[model samples]
Target: MFLLWFLACGLVDAEGEPRIEAHRCAAGYYPENSATGCAKALEAGFGTLEFDLVLTRDDVAVIHHDPFVNPEICTLADGTRLGEEEADRVYFKDITAAEARAGYLCGGIEVEDFPTQALVDEPIMTWAELLDMIEGHPDVYLHIDIKWEGDLSRPPDTYARVVMEEFWARELPNDYYVSAEYPEPLQEVEKLDSSVVTSWSWPSFPDGESTTLVAIGHELQTTLGTEDLVQLANDAKVDELNIPWQVADRRRVEDAVASGLPIQLWTLNTAAGLEAFGKWPVEALITDYPAGDAP
Candidate 1:
């Protein structure tokens, strides 16, 4: 159906041009949040790549999905495998980024969880390491999901500044975008340098309410109505809105489009889901499989 609509709407040609963002640096192929994952996505013809950033004890940001090391996937530097119960206690906040990097082999473990992931010994990479991989490929777009877990190791502004400073130093023409569930860090980012593109990640609850907008590190704000969502985004100085595809219905898409704010849908995996969402007016679709259904 999307293929038919694609021709009718002229959305894309044989090249399939609806923007596809490789979520977690193509988590389907490599270890999630690794430099190799970033490289693989760029080589696979994905122009946009997304990864999660969590701060280490020394205020250095690194690429990792969960705030802690997972026992199922990672083995410590001395080959210590933490039990499920002990994993969460080993927080990245307790260790320096260098210590964190030296402490793990991120791939080839958890075979039952990600059987298809390629076997490689990858260090937990720094934000700088990942960014370095993208420098020569200016055509690529980087989307950062800045994770804030209420850790006071670094001030909120300091956290945002470190990340934004990397982008500012690049001076490349708008090749990056940052997103957070709340506005605190991004607000600080804007304060430091308004030139960087930032998006507020608005959440949708299961109770059928699509109006929950969180400004973490500040306050919890609710939208008066569905129609007001777009205007609220603009008023907040948000460049775009990132919503999970499961909760983004027709009205949400229409409302976003009406307000002139682009929507990037998250974690849509299957080809059918991709095709269905492609029919919408979304700016980007984020997924783990950029080169889908591959060996």
Candidate 2:
């Protein structure tokens, strides 16, 4: 109870609504411009934050989706990318994680999603920094999708769990949800903190670990199929089912609901689809649109 109250104190601010984070602070707009887009998300009363985590050349954690500099947002101010076409020259692999941070201005450094996004020039921060951001806003919950480098040298989930232990050891509030496609990584996360909700990501890997949304026909088996995963999540005390938005019609969504699993569609933008999919109960969703960032 004391912990809860302490956190609640951080939630109250001059503004009545909590600053629920929606999209990553797109690489563009920030406080100087109109705060309408992202700020409105906060104002709309969503208290959970979602963003991608990338490793800098230094191996420091940064908030980015791609392992390489995105051509879509690459600019010359940070580094020489000849043209947007030259983004391939800047593949994150070419540089160490450290160099990646030094090389590019991140987050609001490029084309911004909202006028509210502040242009950040510093290197991407460590996962620790991401946690600190969440901790500061006591009332805010987080839905962080794990970003793997695809090196296959080490499991991405394992690296994340170690950092997560730091958060847990600090007695950080259990207000965030983590999802990953790697089996070993996701399982490792379960060992690290079972109470912290976990989600099975798709495109099932070698061990078939990340296949959260498997075919319905394959669900009724002892094997590690989609059905098994749904049960595993439930047995492991996971909270919801997260699937790609294009997982097909409402009938599938309705079946998932019938099983008592709430659907959380990934990386959606338009509101029209959301309204249409509203027929089924959606526990959460990941969207690029900060305009309607509220859950």
Candidate 3:
């Protein structure tokens, strides 16, 4: 009861609307990271759309989540499909943006986990196409998660430069953010355009641990100390801190707020989670169903 009151009467600013960022443009109802999904989110009155970005073989930026295509969310554009054995072998970095689009149809494969998701034949959107969609809606914000897998064989600076250059060429009208777990890409973004917002995202664990253990591990690590964590974000020239919801407890949120940086909690999907956190004063809620009413 107290927690609910605190969220309703304390956390939110009197003058500010609770900022809601649609995860993958409301992936609960539409295909994750699809153009049509984003359109639905915008039409539903969400002010922000959070999506993913991966560079194609030719260094063009395209909107997709996994470093490689997942057969569960996508399938081959050609008459022949990618066999299960070929799924992990094909890399987005090896295909041109057009080839990437011509190669697969997004939202076609039904995600068993997200049965509510409307399956539609939407093509994987290029960063350029996404920018074009949001061109007139200056109020709509974008959160671009740079999906980089550590292939130390390639320089981070080179990849960062490519991503940043793509943003520059488009000159998006709305305020957009670029973030990664590491500082290299953000550093490059800062160097290229300080005006554009940059963020640093960290998981509860190293990122591939079991889901059940992540919350416990995150609490143990971040709770032990926060000064170093706060300092690291500052050193990275990050404009904001993006932490998983599980670790953004009162103490951690307070610590981050004290550092003078606004924080965003990521990937919350339930109404219970939303209503619970809605009372806590944070920058925004990153959710799959942003339109759902929460207490």
Q: Best lDDT goes to which candidate? A: 3
Per-prediction CA RMSD (Å): 6.0, 11.4, 3.9
* Global lDDT of each candidate: 0.73, 0.51, 0.74
- Write down the RMSD of candidate 1 (Cα, Å): 6.0
Better of 2 and 3 by lDDT: 3
**lDDT-sorted candidate list, best first:** 3, 1, 2
Instruction: Write one digit per residue (lDDT tens) for candidate 1, span 29-143.
Output: 8878777877888777687889888788888888887667767678877777766774345677778988888877676575564577786657888988887777778888879
Local error of candidate 2 at 145, Å? 1.2
- Tell me which residue pairs clash in candidate 3: 7-279, 57-93
Candidate 2 — worst ten consecutive residues by lDDT sum?
A: 26-35
Model 3 / residue 17 / CA error / Å? 5.3
> How close is every model to the real structure, measured as TM-score?
0.81, 0.64, 0.84
